[model samples]
Target: MILPCFLFTSLFMVKLSQRAWNNVIIVSMLALIMLFNLSSNFLNDDSDAPAFSTLIPQGLLISTIEFSNAKVERVGQGWRIESKLSVSKDLQGLLDVWQSVEVSPFEENLQWGDSQPKVTVWFIGQAEPIEYYFLILADKTLVKLGQQTYQLVNVNYQTLIPTE
Candidate 1:
């Protein structure tokens, strides 16, 4: 009976050690995976997709415009913002102004006339709705888009704005 007890105890101890080693390996593997992910952002991989701005989707139109980048939402089509300068009121007019703009990279902020007066415009396109951000600083405008940024030259600031 004594010999049998000794054999049983030894078997149990061996099984316990095996389970402990397996747990340690699993934990180590998980830690390595996490470290790799955290470092990926710093890699300068040119093939990476362009980072689009955080404009709301399903917002086929600009709902509201404020100075501080808040109070702006991508409201769906058929939504109208009836403020003093509302895009829905005269979209065709604004499009005309945008069409006249020369698409180029923004170089310098030369004009400072319209700096204090910031206007937010909600734009609607045939395919989708997006918010068009602009500084409207002068004859040229600094426009912010999701996929890219541009400087629209030789544009009328007031006509491009949405008005009631």
Candidate 2:
């Protein structure tokens, strides 16, 4: 009778151990799935949309970027920035990004107030400067043409005009 009791106890322990392992495996898989979802930028839905557009026009060299208060102009092979706010250390990289920046059509139509910040890009040999009204929000930067609005996918507000 004692031998039978001992055998029963051992089988119960084995069963509990197997059940605990199964639970652990399920929890691990769930954790992995959650991690993957968090790592991906789920809000960026226009992943398939192409970045390059005719906004700036290809092959044309940019001459100057005039902001509301700041100015960045091409100087020889490099660029010179004039601004009260501290500019990025990689000024050339920032300019190159603006030159060929990727943009997507903004979903909402925004009404511009009287004091909306603006930027004008002047290209070499071009007669007219391309003007764009910009709004810098917490999460994204929106650029407005005459009637259409676009979201700047590659760069942000602080990247273009850093406070620090």
Residue pairs that clash (backbone atoms under 3 angstroms), model 1: 59-74, 60-129, 62-122, 85-162, 86-162
lDDT of 1 by residue, 18-129 (tens): 7776775687589778878877855756465433222223333444444332233334533233344343445444544444555555545343433434544445554434
Best by TM-score: 2
Model 1 TM-score relative to the real fold? 0.39
For model 2, give the RMSD to the true fold: 15.4
lDDT scores in order:
0.50, 0.76
Q: Tell me how candidate 2 scores on lDDT.
A: 0.76
Taking all chains together, each candidate's TM-score versus the true structure is: 0.39, 0.59
Deviating ranges (above 4 Å) for candidate 1: 1-18, 45-64, 67-80, 84-104, 114-117, 120-140, 143-150, 153-164
Q: Tens digit of lDDT per residue, candidate 2, span 70-145?
A: 8888999998888887865577877766766777888796777867778788999999988888888888988887
lDDT of 2 at 12: 59
Cα displacement (angstroms), candidate 1, residue 60, comes to 15
lDDT (Cα, 0-100) at 92 in candidate 2: 82
